[model samples]
Target: MMRFAVLGSGSGGNAAVVECGGLRLMIDAGLSAKQLSARLQSVGIDPKSLDGILLTHEHGDHVRGLKVFLKQNPIPVYTTPATARVVRETGIDGGTWKFFEAGQAFTLGGISVETFAIQHDAVDPVGFVLGDQSRRLGFLSDAGFVTRSMTERLRGLAGLFVEANYDEGLLEADTKRPWSIKQRISSRHGHLSNTQVTELIREISHPALGRVVLGHLSSDCNTPDIILNRLRACLGELGHGHVGLHCAGQHEPSDWFDF
Candidate 1:
């Protein structure tokens, strides 16, 4: 059996946990140490019992709490060499480092995790597909666009956690960001818009895919209702209306999704 929970998700922070075969692993520790510990407890997991932490990139929103959290718990941190270098430059060196290259497959405890490159501004950003024989879970956030390799690697997932960062119309109408920032946001190496996320979901969805949790939303430019409606409609059009859809928010943890 595979069960997971998104502790929180958005530009403010991002984190999630995956449990399978008695092994518990945290995908990121972007929340404060206190929130991370409390959210883990909320999900009935002890922070100290975590087998490891897998990092997708070196961005602050994905790794802000790693140093302090690992200092208290002392778990191993896994990521690519390039990403580790960038994170180390930020003075975060509390956990033991386990480096793996992009497009590599590795085993931690009983789960098999496969990594692939993703389009993001950060150095060596990657997405993960973890599973055993029974079920697979795909995690992809901070992605600018979906790559061919990503689509191929993320197939056959029981659950998918992906980014839907912004809605094009809302982003364009927003008054806060200037033209340059808006350009950066909609760039190829920035973040995935709602339309792009919907396209990605349509390309990789399968009948066995049970749940889709959208994350990394723009607090200022995106609304849950908007993206949820778009995703629901897309799935329905594809004859996959049975798929479960949930949007993860920054301020609170989401309910555990079991497969």
Candidate 2:
């Protein structure tokens, strides 16, 4: 069986630890090494045992503390060529880096992982589909639009983590943010709104879909209740209200789910 947990999930920072078989893997290290260690300890995982860090993009919120964190433990970092160029330019340590295509399948820590392109501002951004021999989990975030490619690649998962970043009504009414900021969030490379998320959920909902986690929310444009109630209402209407829904918190991690 494989287990996963969110160390923290949001634009403030993000990280997830996945344990499968005898391997321990990290999805991203948006937090500092110290913070990452503490978060891992909170879930009873030792930072020293991390085998790798799989990067989704080169955004600061996703790679800020990477250098310091890899300094001591030196886990292999996997990313695309475009992301590696920026990581090098940033003077991040290269000793633990490896390069891979953003839309190919690969192995890390003895488990299989597949990467698929997602719409984002970075040179090459992606969402991940990871699994062991028995089960699969999909992680999709930071994408502005969900392409047909996304729906096809993310099918048939035991666990799913996707962004439900904002409410359309909230985003439209918030004049406090500049026009450009709002436009970007509403753009093709921006985040997904609550409706887009549930819409995508309907497209991907299958019998094998076991757990769903909503993550990478905008602190200004969304609240847990707003997103939750919307999903609950939709799922209840669809007669699948019993599905487990987890809302990621900005200040703390969420509980681990086993599959």
Candidate 3:
């Protein structure tokens, strides 16, 4: 069995735990060490029990707690060489760092992980698909737009944790953020919009896709009801109403989902 939980997801911090049998890996370490530990414990997992940490990029929202977490746990950190270099430039050194190139597959214990390049402003950002022998989980967050290669790579997964960063209309109408920031959010190198996410879901839909979790929501411009309703409407039109849907929150961890 494969089980996973999003410790937290949003602009403040983002992290998730993916476990298969005795292997448990963390996807990011955005929260502080203390907060990460508390969240892990809430999910009945000891922080020290993780096999390793896989990074999606060097962005602070994805790696803020990495240095402190490594100081306490000292496990291997897997990421692209470019991201690793930037991470070191940020004064986060030490720990076992293993660099992997995009479009390659690596094995960690009983699980297999495949990395693919993603469109993001950060240095060499990527997405990951992890699986044991029987089940696969696709994770794609912080990407600006979905590509043909990404859709091909993510097809037919048992579970998917994808970004639904913001609603285009809501974001464009919001006056709190500056125009430049809004432009960046909607740019090719920025986060994926709700419509983009819906398009991705439609393109990647498969019979084996059992679960879909909307992640990395904008706390100010997006709401759970809007995202959920939009996704449901899209999937329903495509005859995928049977697929289980969940949303990852910014402040709290989501329930453990088993595949």
Q: Indicate the worst ten consecutive residues by lDDT in candidate 2.
A: 93-102
Query: What TM value does model 2 have?
Result: 0.96
> Candidate 1: worst 10 consecutive residues by lDDT?
143-152
The list of candidate 2 runs beyond 4 A from truth reads none
Residues 181-240 of candidate 2 have per-residue lDDT tens digits of 999988999889998898988887776677889999888889889988888887777777
| lDDT leaderboard ranking | 1, 3, 2
- For 74-153, candidate 3 gives per-residue lDDT tens digits of 99999989999999898888799998998889998889999999999998999999998888999998999888999999
Error of 2 at 85 (Å): 1.1
Task: Please identify model 3 stretches exceeding 4 Å from their true place.
Answer: none
Q: In candidate 1, which residue pairs clash?
A: none
Q: How displaced is residue 159 in candidate 1, in Å?
A: 0.7
Task: RMSD for all candidates, in order, please.
Answer: 0.9, 1.2, 0.9
**Candidate models: Cα lDDT each:** 0.93, 0.86, 0.92
